[model samples]
Target: MQKVTLRFSHNNPSCLPDYRNHSRSLKKVLQELNIPTWQRKRIPFLYYDDELVAAIGFFVCQAYVLQESEPSLHITWAS
Candidate 1:
């Protein structure tokens, strides 16, 4: 398969179907952001390696992103 450095976005994650993992991501976002139920409905999702392991902001959730010459990407965030 070809390697791609997905410019991860809530509008588009460029990944495959993974509902269970995606749900977990929703939970994480809810817990992390402490957003209300209505607001929680708004935050989009992205899947990294078949898992919801990252978060991105609409205007800005993901703060730092580091890339290597590999398919793997490191995403970080801080309050």
Candidate 2:
């Protein structure tokens, strides 16, 4: 699994890419996992201190397991 951070504010920051762009990025990544269209319609989320900060799974990822072999889980973030 990979780690990422996303900061959201009323005024967009130059450091962070536009949140609207997450759809395209998520689609590209989920394509590899063969995520269904229905799931794709689901929203992504982000949390801060157990508080929901954003619906931006497309923004930041938690963990993904592509495959498993006993105690092993082959997980990779979409580039």
Clashing pairs in 1: 56-61, 57-61
lDDT of 2: 0.39
Off by over 4 Å in 1: 1-29, 58-79
* lDDT (Cα, tens digit) per residue for candidate 1, span 4-65: 23333443322212222232334544454566757655554444444443444532223223
Clashes of each: 2, 3
Over 1-79, each residue of candidate 2 has an lDDT whose tens digit, in order, gives 4343433321211122233333334345545457676775554444343333343444333232223544743334353
The residue pairs found clashing in candidate 2 are 44-56, 44-57, 45-57
Candidate 2, which segments miss by more than 4 Å at Cα? 1-24, 47-79
Per-prediction TM-score: 0.35, 0.27
Score residue 9 of candidate 1 by CA lDDT: 41
User: What C-alpha lDDT do the candidate models reach, one value each?
Assistant: 0.40, 0.39
lDDT of 1: 0.40
User: How many residue pairs in model 2 have overlapping backbones?
Assistant: 3
